[model samples]
Target: MTPTHAARLVRELSQPLVSGAFLAARDRERLLEVLPSATGETLDAFAAAAVAVRRARIGDAASLCAIVSAKSGRCGENCAFCAQSGHYATNAPQHPLLPPERIVAAAAAMARRGVTRFGVVASGKALPDAELESVATALAGIAALPMAADASLGVLSEDALARLKAAGLAAYHHNLETSRAFYPSICTSRTFEDNLEVLRACRRSGIPVCSGGLFGMGETWADRADLALTLLEAGVFSVPVNFLSPIAGTPLANRPVLSRDEARRIVVLLRFLLPDRHIRICGGRPTVFGRDASLAPMAAGADGLMVGDYLTTSGGMPDADRQGLRRLGFVVAQAG
Candidate 1:
C-alpha cells in the first residue's frame, strides 16, 4: 500500500477502537495489514489508536507484577530459547528451591517498591515432588506479604495447585509460549497440549491464569496471531507478551533482536486483539527496546508491566519503571 493509503487505512480503521468495542472480523483483517509493516508512519498511528483502546477499556493505570526466580536451572525441557534448559550446556548453575524466608523477602522487596502482584517462577517441566513441601512453605510466607501472590512452578499437578491456593496463591502462570503449530520448533520435551491442560487444571482449582508467549523466535506473523487467539479462547486474563531474550550457549543465542517498532507493534496488535485484558510487556522489553522502552510500552497500548528481574535475566529496575509510569501519566493500580 502507498504511504497515503496506509495513512488513510490506519485513521479510518482505528476509529471504532476508541469506543472500546472489539475488533470486528473486518477490523481484524485491516489490522493484520496495519500491524506487520516493519516500517511506517501508519504503525505509529496504529499504536496511538491502540493506546486509545487501552485507555477506554482498561483505563490509564498500569498493573504491576514482580517475579522471583524461586528455583532455577536444570530444567529438563528443551525449549531452545531458554537459559535454564538442561538440553544445552548453558553453564546455568542450579539453585535449589528457595526457603520460605528468602521467598518472602523477595516479595516484600518488590512490595516496598510499589508492586502489588508478585510471582515465584521456577525453571522446570514441574516442581520436584521433594521440593513441594518447601515450595508450600514459601507460599505461606509469600501469602503474608502485602501483595497478591502467583506461582509458575512448571506443569504443576492439581495437588500442588491446591497446596499453593491454600497457602494464598491466587494466580497461576504458564505460558503457551507460541502457537500450537509452532510448538514443535520451540520445544520437544513438552507439547502445547501439556501446558494447556495445566492451565485448565489451574482454572479448575479456582486460580486465575496468567499465560502468554515469546515473540521474535523466527515464527511468522500468523504464529503470533494464532498464539494470541489461542490465549483469548483459553480465557487467559493476563497476557505477558515476552520478546525472545536470547542467552549465549542456548540454541537461539545468536538470533537477531527484533526491531523496536516491531516490538511496539506487537503490543499494539495485542491491545487491539484483547482490549479488556492485561497486555503485559514482560522480560525482554529492555533487550528489544534499549531506550524509551518503559514509556514506549505504556504509550503503545500496554497496561501491565512486569517489574524487577526475570527468571534468568535482569530487566528494567523497579524505580525506573515507577518513574516511567508517572512520566506517562499512569498510576499504579493497587494490587489485589
Candidate 2:
C-alpha cells in the first residue's frame, strides 16, 4: 500500500471511533491487508491513530498487573519459546505449588506497588486436583486484598473454573501463543482449538477472559493479525500482548527479538483492532525494549502493564514502573 493510501485508511478507521461509531469489520480487513507493508510514515500514522483510539476508548488510566509463578517448570507442552517447557532443558525455576500464604504475600507486595490485578500462573498442561485446592486457597487470600485474582493454569474443565471462581477467581488467562495457522509450528502437544475452548469456557462460566499471543516467533504479519482477530472473535476483555524472549534450549532459541518499531506497531495494531479491550503489554516488555524504553509500548497505545518479575525473566521494577507511567502522564490504575 502507498503511504498516502495507508494514511487515509488509518484516518478513516479513526473517524468512525471519533464519532462514537464502531469500526466496520470490512475496514479492519483492509487495515490487515496493508499492515504487512506498513512502514516509515505509514507506521507513524498507525501509532497516532492507535493513541487517539486508546485515549477515546479507555482514557489515561493505565492498568498495572503482576503474576506469581506459583507452580513452575515441567510443562507438558513443547511451546518453542518457553524456557519452562519440559521438552527443553533450560535453567528456568522449578517448584511445587507454593503455599497460600506465599502467593498472597507476593500479591500483597505488588498490590502495595499499585498492581490491581495479580495472576497465579503455573506451567503444567492443567492444574492437578491437588494443586487446584492450594491455588483456590491462594485466590481467597488474594481476593481479600481486594485485587483481581487471575489464573493461567492451562486448560481446565468448566467444573474446575467454577471451583476457582467460587474461590474468588476474577479472570482466567490462557494465551493462544500464536495464530491457528502457525500454532502447530511452535507447539505440537496442543492445538489452537484446545486453547480456544478455554476461552469459550470462561465466557460460558461468566468469567472474564484475558487472552492474546506472543509475537516475534518467526511468524508473518498475517499470523499476527489472525491472532488479534481470533482474540476479538473470542470476546476476550483483556489482550495481553507478549513479544518472544527466545529462551535457549528451545526450538526458537536462535530467533531474533522483534525490532522496536515492529514491536510498537504490533501494539498499535492491537489497539486498533481491539478498540475497547484492555491492550496490556506483558512478558516481553523488558526483553524487547529493555529498561530505558520499557514504557514505549504505552506511548504507542498499550494502557496496561505486567510489572515485576516475569515467569522466567527479569521485569520492570514495580515502584519504578509506577513512577515511569506517571512521568508519561498516565494515572496508575487504583486499587479496588
| lDDT of all predictions | 0.84, 0.88
Tens-place lDDT per residue, model 2, 1-336, is 678877898898787775556657798788777765678888878888887888888898988999999989989888889999999989999998889999999999888878999999998899998788899999999999958999999999999999999999999999998899999999999899999999999999999999988999998877887898889899999999999998889989999999888898889878877888899999889988988899989988889999888999988887888888889888986543
Model 1 misplaced regions, further than 4 Å: 2-4, 333-336
Question: Whole-model lDDT, candidate 1?
Answer: 0.84
Query: How much RMSD separates candidate 2 from the native structure?
Result: 1.8
Name the 10 consecutive residues with the lowest summed lDDT in model 2.
Answer: 15-24
**Residue range with the least summed lDDT across 10 consecutive positions in model 1:** 327-336
How well does each candidate superpose onto the true structure, as a TM-score?
A: 0.94, 0.95
Top candidate when judged by TM-score against the true structure: 2
Residue-wise lDDT of candidate 1 within 69-152, one digit each (tens)? 988898889998998988898866689788878988989888888788888888889988888878777777877777788888
Score residue 133 of candidate 2 by CA lDDT: 88
